[model samples]
Target chain A: MDYGTTPLHGLPSRVTICEVGPRDGLQNEQAVLPVEVKAEFVARLVDAGHTLIETTSFVPAKWIPQLADAEELLDAITLAPGVRYPVLVPNERGLERALAAGVRDIAVFGSVTETFARRNLNRTVDESLAMFTPVVARAREAGLGVRGYLSMCFGDPWEGEVPVERVVEVATRMMALGCTQLSLGDTIGVATPGRVVAVLDALAAAGIPVDAIAVHFHDTYGQALANTFTALGHGVTTIDASAGGLGGCPYAGSATGNLATEDLLWHLHGLGIETGIDLQKMVDTSIWLAAKLGRPSPSRAVTALGDPLPR
Target chain B: MDYGTTPLHGLPSRVTICEVGPRDGLQNEQAVLPVEVKAEFVARLVDAGHTLIETTSFVPAKWIPQLADAEELLDAITLAPGVRYPVLVPNERGLERALAAGVRDIAVFGSVTETFARRNLNRTVDESLAMFTPVVARAREAGLGVRGYLSMCFGDPWEGEVPVERVVEVATRMMALGCTQLSLGDTIGVATPGRVVAVLDALAAAGIPVDAIAVHFHDTYGQALANTFTALGHGVTTIDASAGGLGGCPYAGSATGNLATEDLLWHLHGLGIETGIDLQKMVDTSIWLAAKLGRPSPSRAVTALGDPLPR
Candidate 1:
């Protein structure tokens, strides 16, 4: 419990964790919980001091049955005053659905690799960008903050290692769509620290400030926290994580879940960086949600500190 | 897998991994594997390009029945040239047994906290040091390499938080006792990157060179890999790991296993740090060992890539 507070140089004094358990996490789950449960999940996260939570996606019910009750979930939960609930909006139709739900922040998910763009978004790279362009434009016009998610920025299943230049190009295009923040994702979770530095340096070289970038990593090879450490050293302040390491890549068959929020907080809070989230509360939330999901949480922090709350 | 080799500025280009699955890992398991299986495990690790391995301990059979066949195991396996197999020796008796078994490298385990020293070594901190003094002296006089393991270097359950000065003091004593190398252990896995940096910096300030220090971390809170990354940044080239994340702290009820060698290799190899071990071979070894132990591996790399061996 006593994490000796020692701050490192060149790292952010505070970090913003964007909880994606309700959306990115549940979307890949086989068990579809009721809308009320999803609502409670978001509420528990907010109670744990998460200010930014990705509520759900507005995709069609037939596509992702797990998150089909997005509208009902939004209606079921109370919106905290300062909390920002961002929903993933794939295209113009999804954006319309989000707007109707009184969403203030929306995110557009794009793919860095051509193969993933076609497979995941059902469009080529440029076509997917074209689809998101109007969605972002409309969201921006509606005074909704737009967050751009660039998936497969590190690697792609069909197309091996993604080029940094290609990621930079797609990232700039996504940012040009009026997105306030861009979450660079290692979709298949094959990124190491060096590759992380390379991509971030390339983005900086392309005139993209570190403040505008958020890192979303997976623990597929147990490199998530280490890679996150590298990103923090590069001055990245925003991170996307799931409560219990909830979601695996639906595309990459061997991919693991997103970096667990508990694990990330353990690293952040130990470094004397203020995140404003209660570690114990978040661990309890993850444990409670894991029971609802009929499985144990994959987060190491949850596994180690979950059973009896570890003093 | 095209890890995009980009070396960090301050990290070591090559790292030496000391595989402890046979000794440190198996010691905590309820199932005591046959000596033949243990020999094969060591063989497989050597085949996977591990240059250094902790073969077994010289403790009495009553203390650790799991490694009771230490002499038999040393005789059963073929010791490859250039590979160093270190055996744990508790005192002069254990050292005599290790020397009788023809062990060229022996390690003495000490504690940074007094409570753990009394609980684990059955002696107070200074008393334990006094006990190890003669063993280290005799080992060095016998032309054998000596490694000193300082456990609970970051936090202690009974003591709460361990001071940095205490760690440096014990580390210097261990080194002064003629230990060729000293491994700083985060026994309960409660360490973070900043604390790791702080400890290493304090040790460096106390005239303990980085090259003489190795890091042994547990993944109790999922901070092992992140903490290892911090150690590498501090120019510590040697790392202690277990195949398949084999061992858990018997003292800490909620503690998980040691840092998985497969997971560690995934990070090190991905960073373009030359640790000669083959990742696939190590994963296969963990999978095979997990099967023999009748349990799935705790390593994320094994879980993510072990299903069918991703292309």
Candidate 2:
């Protein structure tokens, strides 16, 4: 078998990875990384073969001070030609900043649960969607690719359990609006395999193509990988993962961030799944970031594979 | 709905927890946990509602230096009435020591993979089983309950994949030898949901009672909980988990330990399964143990809970 970028099956010769470390990851860290370090980290990720890199979120500085350098970071970082770096844009203003910073791809997010929408983004579910409509329209007119995030699609902290129909309705609206792909976010990380199956079942029954669906899960409760397997078993391929489990939800107190890329890739490779990302490189990057943050990694794979500390 | 210890589906209103931190947990840690700390830790676990605990192994001290104080720890720890403390016995000699220590239960382990068995215990698969036959017979005659472990039942380090038939054969032989329950170990943590389903199906087809089976999984590749879900869906009730995701095979270089008890309980509770362990208490104990080890807890759930660090 070829060591680098080998095909899993005859179906495809490669896998596309959407690295969310710079955006989802850095935003969740308690220690705000310096702009130079953030630029270096993003450059390292690009060097490590991450194609679809989520650069930064264009949220207000007061909302998430960690990524307040979104504009500067995007401008300072060296961009490679084939790499597609997408920034999170909440409104036309955020989109304008991203476009000004030379961003060719932008992502807009809304919530499925009204309670979470109000608490997280300070808007109602409908209001959140409406806020993104103009952003999506303006981005599409600028020849930019648009991706919509449906937060708390599986469950919400305040609402406990979300109805599948509500998630589907929001997802359908996003897809119908100029968004090319819909990523379902299990924001609070309370999902199980059965619940994942239930959500996918409802969505498929609603005449949604599995190809348009991407699953995002946090490893807060360690169900991310299982849920990912369930999603993959449903033939929904796209997955969003942080490089080192670097992100955590501030609202969902004590919630870990997105699934670790190293851990997720380890399982994918073991199961003969073709994910183009390198596992060892991802582990090394996690080690570096964990040291920078003065902590052990949130990723189990990185801990297990990295060098053992002297007793 | 009550969150307290109430009966679910009329199956025992309470659960019997067996903490493997002493034998299964500490043996896999790089640094040796002091005998006093180990004893105190076991005492704390017992105080926190664990009635049955696997205290330590009877293996030679030279083999695993980290657990060299097994006898001392077992001797110094206070045992509660009706609390069954079991120790692993590799052979007749190991059994003699455990029996002398007043242990009421003895566990004998055999691996499904010949390669893992040889690398792990310095004996081939058949040789190891042959070595355990007399130990099991002796434990039975000595009026001690016997539990058998089939390691690498899911996957192995040297051998990439293990067949279900191989696991069934080992399980059947162990059952015929008077082992009360067979704990299938996912040694390298490569078992996925589909593979777990297939293994359970094969075991059932061979007439193995689901109730008599316990699943032990490592989160090496993040599939332990997923595998546990598959086992539970098939009616297997008993689960084996470590306190803080401690322990890994000495043979498998970077394999993670068993799934964290807190994470497993969270999923089981979400599924409405009756595993009478308190989630909060488990998290507290894990944090306490991590403090003793002077490192972050391997469990994401423990860290995510964001409880104050143990003094």
Candidate 3:
């Protein structure tokens, strides 16, 4: 009932920003950049004070060809002290590949919808969850921090709308699978703040602690920042954002991309929430990446703040 | 507390959208469209099921030349029986001009910041309010529904952050002057949902009903729709938005423009809140307007939901 902006809104004083530009962002880009460009982008994000960076995905080279140079990228960039590099691991083989590439932290992705699980991972929802369990266990046994991704948590293109209860059930099981953190992903970006609150409350009621949850949102419908704020208000931190909103998946009905790092930081800095992100540096990075990607960034702040108006 | 995406999140079942694209939107444009084009734009909006279209402003030609077509535009358009055409009146002379143009609904604009008032109206806040007293009286005596706009309610670029109480005071004074509704304007777009809730709750504590208040936001920081969602949660229904998020004022520090109607409709429709807007038609109007304005729209929905990717 406290309607004040004095940091008492249950938002975390310091939020962990998991920069996913190198892996999630570039993998969705139509034009694949050179491995050095990807490495530099990661290095720039690291320079911008992002402690946790999703470096790459260890899937087969053909699966996400844009990020095929995951190993090449990892080798080129210097791993700084206190910085965590988390890469996506689809299964044990992906985990092995990631381990071979010196990945100490890894993400395992699943889906709440049967259709997304089927189409994306070629497995049903239960099958995908079943698949992630061992991958997570193996990663944790390897002393790697595991981040669980629950895709289509809000709505799926084929499934219409996802129930919060279903999401909660799967999320709980994922956390039970030794996953350290769960990021409830709105893959289609249809989740509103109200819906976000609903999902988070459902997870809490099912005994999932707030400390174990991160909210990853795509800015498809411009609901990303608002949903992020709502998540923050619910004691959720560890937001996953892409530099320049890089991953615009055109095949996915309405997936614009992940929340832009600059856009997210602007709101956080304004609300006095510390993310330790040098926003001006992020903007410069986004502008630089926008050029390398051969497109404008979908970030509102990137467009509004400094980038020249195309008009 | 129900985390269900059901209809019961304290949001109004029906919401009113006041279209301010013409008066507020075009006035900020660098290039002025001719009177006929402006008239056609208004007609297109009316055809797209917007009942309340802010047709034009009756201010001096030199001040806001973009809307200098006030008389001509009002004269050209055929006002529908049920649709309300609200033209802005800056003073008694502007009101007289509006009345001469057969306007039945009018709006009076003011600023919460003394700096904005001095810059825009050439007076301090008190002096500007004093100047509007007779304008409101004349418009009310003529039986015209007068909507009041209190800008910089959340922030002022020159004066910095405006306290919620100062906003409430100016808003209360505006409502007392026979203004039918008071729009709390986040002119600088620095308002977050928490700030919005704080300001609205302060107003409610001051005995103002949420029904009599509307929120006007610019998408400067990508907080418009989120702020709107927060306002809706507080039982405030009426919202102000531009058709294409058309108003981008470069000089306003952070004020990008009004929240796009398409972006707003996208979120409301997603939440199952009814606005009676034909979103496709609105998109078409925006596409057409964007072409006329020689720039891509700042609206995410306009870009994402067909109308062609402006990237």
Interface DockQ per candidate: 0.68, 0.28, 0.37
lDDT of 1 at B146: 97
TM-score of 1: 0.99
Q: List model 2 lDDT by residue over A65-180, tens digit each.
A: 99999978987898998899999998889988998899999998788988878888899888888898888988889899998888887777666767778988998888778897
Candidate 2: global Cα-lDDT? Answer: 0.78
Candidate of highest DockQ: 1
Error of 2 at B34 (Å): 7.2
The DockQ value obtained for model 3 is 0.37
Candidate 1 chain A, run of 10 with poorest lDDT = A302-311
**Residues A14-90, candidate 3, lDDT per residue (tens digit)?**
99999988888888888889988888888898899999999989889888888888888889989999899999989
Better of 1 and 3 by lDDT: 1
Q: Give TM per candidate.
A: 0.99, 0.84, 0.92
For candidate 1 chain B, the 10 contiguous residues with the lowest summed lDDT are B1-10
- Residue-level lDDT tens digits of model 2 in B1-311: 12111112322222344567777988988778888888877887777667667889888889878877777877898789877788898899999999888889989888998888888778988888889888888888988988899998876666666777899898888988888778888877766655666678888899888777888888876768767766665677677888888887777775778888878776766655556567778788888888887776777677766455321
Q: After superposing the true interface residues, what Cα RMSD does each candidate give?
A: 1.9, 7.3, 7.6
lDDT of 1 by residue, B73-186 (tens): 999989899999999999999999998888899999999999999889889999999999999999999999999999999898778789999999999999999999999989
Against the true structure, candidate 1 has what lDDT?
0.91
